[model samples]
Target: MTKEFFTATPVKQVFDRIVEFVPVGTEKVPTAETCGRILATDVVAQTHLPGFARSTMDGYAVRAAATFGASESSPAYLEITDTVQMGMAAQAPVGNGQAAGIATGGMLPEGADAVVMLEHAAKLDETALEVYKSVAPGANVVAADEDVAAGQKMLAAGSRIRPQEMGLMAALGMETIRVFKKPVIGIISTGDELVEIGQTPVPGQIRDVNTYSLAGTVGQAGGIARTYGIVADRFDALRSTCTRALSETDMLLISGGSSVGTRDLTLEVIESLPDSQILFHGIPIRPGKPTILAKIGQKALWGLPGQIASAMVVFDRIVARFVGHISGNALSYRQHDRITAELTRNLSSVQGRTDYVRARIVEDQGRFYAEPIPGPSGLIRTLVEADGLIEIDMNTEGLEKGETVFVTLLR
Candidate 1:
């Protein structure tokens, strides 16, 4: 079948369709290693933070009524009854006109409504001090559950655990956390003209670059990638690998064969699987117009572009989304920001197809400028020199120079 045999769906639509087949999986992992993992359940605060009313600074804890109108000329004097210890409750309650020396984080004594810092007070003897500063009720005190209330819901389900999330879990004395399991992805490259990178390339044969790049990309998307090596352009070998990979993994990715003849055999291999159905045969995307997607039972099998750059772009935009959704990390996940820049050259794109133009970002006069890199999409060097991608609408004839546009960063 020719490329005309299939109708292409937009990139965004393809991703939305595939995610319907993905199911959430859960695993219990240690909190120390939970960074980047998605939460499977809501995290509730087990106890109140601080657990008791405590001093916020090194000061004297006294009844607010006793410290009223205290000043420099005629300072209020109070007897220092006791000293509060750290991590322990006050030894005794403060009586009227009496104060207790309390350090930061020390438990506040009963009957004390405020704390006056040491800088505002002077000790005449061990028993009494002249308080020059007046403190209002409940000043400089951290009440029980002030930072966090007991049974309060903190991190919710589908939240990606970050450093701050881990710190919150540690505060609750949580050593283990329940998070979504990483999806297992099986990668297979198929072509007769492909050879390993270490070997010298003969006539009509090129190095296999798609497998390595796709595998690394899968890892960055939070999937466990298993590269099954390059399969020969025979129907039997390709079928066998697809069957085996589908049985072991949640998803399988096959790099399409470049030649017209080999592409038919690859399609036949997918057709042989039980309940296998093609989702999309061609996308209206440039360089990656030959991409395909299929579902074998519950597992997803994707046919990526033969060109290295095309394959990576389609995978990052389409397949990576499904992986993140299944892993339950979609809520807090975000793609790299689009860098604003001025286009260096005019670019043309076909209607109904979104074009990704690779460009190098330059800093001139404290402003960012995007200069389009000139090369065929198949060449790997185009991406190596690109700092970002400038997207053009399908309906636009061409984009003019000096036009401010958003360029999605490669990082």
Candidate 2:
């Protein structure tokens, strides 16, 4: 059966529809293994970080007023009562006309409000010290709760844990944390001309690349990918695979048979499933217009293009977004990394469709320029040779040479 799309849905609208499904459940994991996982609950500080005032330098802990008018010409001298040891409480208070030796990260002695660097002071004797400079109150000392206060929200519910966040959690004594479960995605490659990667293909056949590539993409998006092997384009075989995939995984991705053709059975199989509804069959984006999105119950199913580069582009922009949403980290969860570069050549596009042109970024005279990588979408080398993608908006017909453009980093 042949199908025609009179109108292609906008990319933003398709994303909106994809996020309508609820997110998966959460589970508690050790904080050490929580890196790159989205937090299912807010992490609040139970105790103030650095719960005590600490010295930031190896110097004398003193009252700021005691160092007034102390200079090299006439240095002020004070008796050193005791030395503050690392990880131990101060043994003596810093009284008037008295100084306490303190090391970096040592707790400040009582009545001491500032730290004077070692270079500014000289040891006149074992118990006496001379000050050459005056320091203001609170100088070279980090007050209690300066880094984080009790009850402060350290991380939001949807925040992705990074190395620094893990350190913070460790400081707060959080051994385990609740994080969103990784979504399991079932990937099935459908085509009669497809063969396993290990097998050498004969005439009119090609090795399967989409399954591995899509699986890697799923991992990059923080989802677990389960390959269902390649299925023939026959209606019964594809439908049976689809039914099992939807039941076994949180989402299903069927790559191929999206375009209208005599062998196109993806749409037919999706429609034959119980409680299945096609959210969108096509998108108004170049190289990915033949993509399909459907839902069966609470699970999502996608029909990606057969071409390697086209399938990857659709997966990166569309499938990744939905995966992030269901994992509690939506597209807006973090700022996208982008750089502005001058176009090395003019890029032309149609009026109605948005274009994602891959380009190799070059630096000359400390300025960045994007050189377009020209190749068919079916050629995977086009993406391999490019550093990032430069997008042409739907309203713009083309971009002239030497124009500045934003290059979205592939990572």
Candidate 3:
């Protein structure tokens, strides 16, 4: 059956459709294993962080008023009453006209509201201290709940756990946390002229690079990848594999056979599935214009171009964005690591299509410049040599030499 081709859909519309089909489920994991995982529930602090007033420097704990009118020219003298030890409570209260020697991170004694650094004060005798500078109350001291207050929400639901987040959880005495289970993505590569990586390709045949590269991208996006191996470009063969993969994985990525040709059987196979709906067959973007987004029941099914570079770009712009959202990664698109760089040369593009130009970022004299990597979309080495991608908007005709642009970092 021949199908009529529709106009390419906007990238934002495709993303909006995928958001409606995101799965909802969660699992419990140890705090140590929560890195890169998304929190299913809010993490609230059980007790105040630091729980006590602590010294931020090695100094003397004293009443702020006692140091008034003190300076290097004429210092105020006070008797040393006690020493506050590290990891221990203050032994005695700091009385008026007295100071206690305290180490960094030591608990402040009662009646002491400020800390005077040791460099600003000198020991007059074994028991006497001379203050050379004045300090105000609460100076150099962290309040009991300065970092986090009791009952405060430390992390909201949908937060992706990072190293700092793990440390915060540990500080809150959390050994285990509830996090969303990693989505399992089934990767299938299809082409009549493809061979496994270990085998050398004949004149017309090439290695199956899309599966491995797409699998790595899936992992980087916090999804578990299950490769279904390469399948021949046949209707029945592709349909059988797609059926099993969709049943076994949360999402299925079929790389190759997306364009219109005698061997392009992906659309046929996907349409043959029971209760299948095609969200979009093409995107209005360069290099990845033939990409497809579909839905089978609640699971997402994607058909990426056969070329390695195009597949990677589609995954980065579309698949990765969907994966991050479903995984509850809290970071917005603007929050992703990106930097502005001056273009080394001119780059031309059509007005109706957005373009992702691979570029190598070079730093010289404290300025960053983006040198475009010139190669066809099929060449994987071009992507390898580039550090990031510079995007050309749909309405812009081209970017001139030395024009400032934002480069989306490739991890």
Candidate 4:
């Protein structure tokens, strides 16, 4: 029996329909080992940073009023009380008409509000010093709570931990950090003419590329790839593998059988599963229009295109975001970098579909230009030659040369 093509849904509307039926759980990990992990709870400061006011210059610490009207012509003199040792408490208080020698980062003595740089003051004698510049209160001094205040919220939940966040947690003496658990994504490729990558293809058979490539992309998005070796197009075999995959993984991806074909059996098997609902059967997205998203139980079961290039584009643009969402990260999470550049060529597009044009970015005379790398979607050389993809809006018909656009980088 043959089937007709279904109405295509808009990409955003399809993406908005995704619900996290099984959200990733959280665990406690060492703050130092939390790089790239999404924070599960908000972080608040435990104590004031620095814990004391300190000087930022190597000079005399004195009251701002004591240095008033002090300049090269006429100098204000104050008695030198004591010297603050490095990494030690202030030696003495700065009484009226009194100054204390302080090094950079030295603790500020009581009654001292500013530091006069060494070059701005002169040592007249062993007990007296001349200030050659006027100073304002709080000048050249770091307040006790300047870096962070106690009880202040520092980091928000759902934030990814970076090297700088590690340093901040260290500064705040945070030992354990709450982070979302890494999600486990299942991958399955269905095609009778596909062979393992280890085996060379003979005649019409081709090497399986989607399983391994999708695994790498899944890892980049913080999900553990649980792969089920290539399954044939038979309904029984594919359904058996998917049953085990969904049982073992947070999400299952059936690569192939999304488009309407005699061999396209993913929709039928997915629909037969208990409590399965096909949220979307097709999307108005160029290069990956034959995509299917079904909710099987509480897990997302995706039927991706069988073509190598189309499968990869769908994973990069659509699948990765869903992985991030289930893992408690932001919905629009993307692994590839994006850059803004001027288009060097005019590009045409259909009105009802969003087009992702592969492009090569080049730098000339300090400015960057995005040059279109035009080719059929199935061409492997097109993926190799392009550094990024330029997205044209579905509402627009075309883009003009010299128009600025954002390119989603693949390399």
Candidate 5:
């Protein structure tokens, strides 16, 4: 069946489209081991934080009214009743004209309203204190539930647990936490021209670059890759491999057949699956325009272009975004920073295809300069020398020197 293709969708639209079809999955894991994973559920406080009115410093805890207006020249002296030890509840309460020796984080005596830090007070004896600095009500103290109230939501579902979240979980005595499960992805490389790496290439055959590059990329994007070794250019063998992969993985990624003749067979194998439907037959991006997307029931199946650099770009842009959605993690590309630069020379691009030109970024004083690295997309040196991509807008004629434009950093 003939299928209609779309002009390249904006990057944002592509992301939203995948997210609409995906939902995060759940897994129970120890909170101690949940670092860097997104939380599956909100973490609510089981009990009051601080749980008591506590002193914030080592000094006198007294009625704020008794110490009001007291200063270095004329200080308020109170009879020291006893000391409140840290981590132990105070046994006695304070009253008028009385003070309690409170250490940092000690439970406050019932009638004390404020604590004077040790730096601002002098101890007269075991029974008396001379306060030089005046303290207001609730000063140098933490009220009950000041940090977190009982049953309050301390963290929300989908939160990316960081060091602070781990510390909070530790403080709450949580040894385990619920998190999203990692998605499983199956990768298959197909081509008669492909041979496993480490084997010397014959005249028309090349090393199996797709399997290793794509497997590593999948791992970095939070999915476990199950690789089915390179399938020869045969319909039955390819179909059986796809069947096995679909049965085992949440998603199947087929490196597209190298020659145009085998492309139809690959699609036919995918279409034979029950309830399978092709989503997109092709994309409108340079070097990767033969990309295909499909759905077998609820599982995603993707066909990537055969060229190495093209395959990597499509996977990084589309497959990685899908993985992030299902795993509840941010997209894998480095955070983008935009800077303007003068084009060193005129660059040509197809009017209808969106192009990602590798460019080197340089800084002079505070201004950023982008110099385009001209090479075929398949060249590894293109990426190695590039700091990031210079997006050539679709329908634009060309870029001329001295025009300021935004270039995104690869790092």
Candidate 6:
């Protein structure tokens, strides 16, 4: 039977297919060990962060009206009535024309709305304070809920846990957090020309690159990478390996399986599996146009290109999205991955294909510029020199010099 091939579909359409793969199970992890995990539940603040209004500077806490018009040339004088020590409650409200000495992080005294920095004020006598600068109400002091307010949602579901999030949760008395279980991603490399990394390849063979590269990429995406050894370019070899990998891992990546010479063999092998269906055969993205996406049940199977550069591009730009999504932190890449930078040189692109140009970032002054690294996708040097990838839209013909573009940073 002649099957209808999935032709070049838009990248947006491909992303819409993400609902086909379900995220893994959720588990409760200690807040200290939750870094890099995807949150399965919203983290709410139970109590006010810091829990008290505190001075941010070591100086005097006084009513703003008491220091009005105070400056280096013309100063204001107030009585130094009391001191608030660190780790102690503030007491003895400052009355009119009165100031209370306080250190950084000391609780603010009642009736005091501002603090004068120590550098901006001095004590002329034991009871007299000379203010050289004026402060407004709410100045130099952080409110009780400045970091996070009680009952507020600090982190939403699908948010990735970073070190900062761990610290914030700990401050709110959260000892444990609910997060998605880390995904297990299986990797396979297919080709008769491939040899083990330990063995020096003979004249016709080359060391396997995709297995290591793809595994590292998977690990960086917060998935546990389980690599299966290389499979030769044969239907039976690929079918058996694919079967085992699919059963063993939550997702599978087959490097070089979708290349020109082995495309049909790989497709046939995938079709033989139970409940297998090809999602797409191609995308309009450059360097990865021949990539294939298939599925058996809820597990996603990616047939990445054979070329080193093309395979890496497809995995990083496209497959990484699925991995991140199944981990429950789908927004991690969408929100934080791309950075805007000015293009250093003009780049021409085909109108129909969305081109991804690898580039080095140049920072001159406080501004950043993307310098395109021109080379074939197969060249390893080009990938190494690139700090990020510049995407040219399918409709756009070219990019002009000094044009600002969003570049997806490499992991």
- Model 1 C-alpha RMSD vs. true structure (Å) is 3.1
Candidate 3 local Cα displacement, residue 122, angstroms: 2.0
Deviating ranges (above 4 Å) for candidate 2: 1-6, 331-335
What residue pairs are clashing in model 4? none
Candidates 4 and 5 compared: the better one by TM-score is 4
Stretches off by above 4 angstroms in model 6 are 1-6, 65-79, 91-93, 119-125, 128-136, 332-349, 361-375, 396-407
Q: For model 2, which pairs clash?
A: none
lDDT of 4 at 21: 58
Q: After superposition, how far is residue 378 of candidate 5 from its true place, in Å?
A: 1.7
lDDT leaderboard ranking: 2, 3, 6, 4, 1, 5
Instruction: Give the poorly placed runs of model 5, Cα more than 4 Å off.
Output: 1-16, 19-25, 258-264, 328-353, 359-372, 384-411
Kindly list the per-residue Cα lDDT of model 3 for residues 30-132, writing each as its tens digit. Answer: 8999888989899999999989999999999999999999999989898899999889888899988899999999999999999999999999898999999
Tens-digit lDDT track of model 6 for 2-103: 022235877888889988889999999899999989999998888998999999999999999999999999999999999997898776988879999999
Candidates ranked by TM-score: 2, 3, 4, 1, 6, 5
Give the TM-score comparing model 5 with the true structure, all chains together. 0.83
Question: Model 4: runs farther than 4 Å from truth?
Answer: 1-6, 20-22, 331-337
Which is the winner by lDDT between candidate 1 and candidate 2?
Answer: 2
lDDT, candidate 2, at 383: 86
TM-score of 2: 0.97
Q: Give each prediction's root-mean-square deviation over alpha carbons.
A: 3.1, 2.1, 2.4, 2.7, 4.0, 3.6
lDDT against true structure, model 1:
0.83
* Model 4 whole-model lDDT (C-alpha atoms): 0.87
Predicted candidate 5 versus true structure: per-residue lDDT over 1-411, tens digit per residue: 112224444455555557445655798888778877878888999988878899888888899988888899999888998788777877788998889988888899989999988888888778888888889999999998999898999998866788899999888888888888878899999988899888999899888888887898898777889999899878899989998998998888999662245245778888888888877666666657677788887888888877777787777656777876777664333445667787777788766666777789888898777899887766767777877777787678578877787887653
- Clashes in predicted model 4: 0
* lDDT for 137 (candidate 2): 91
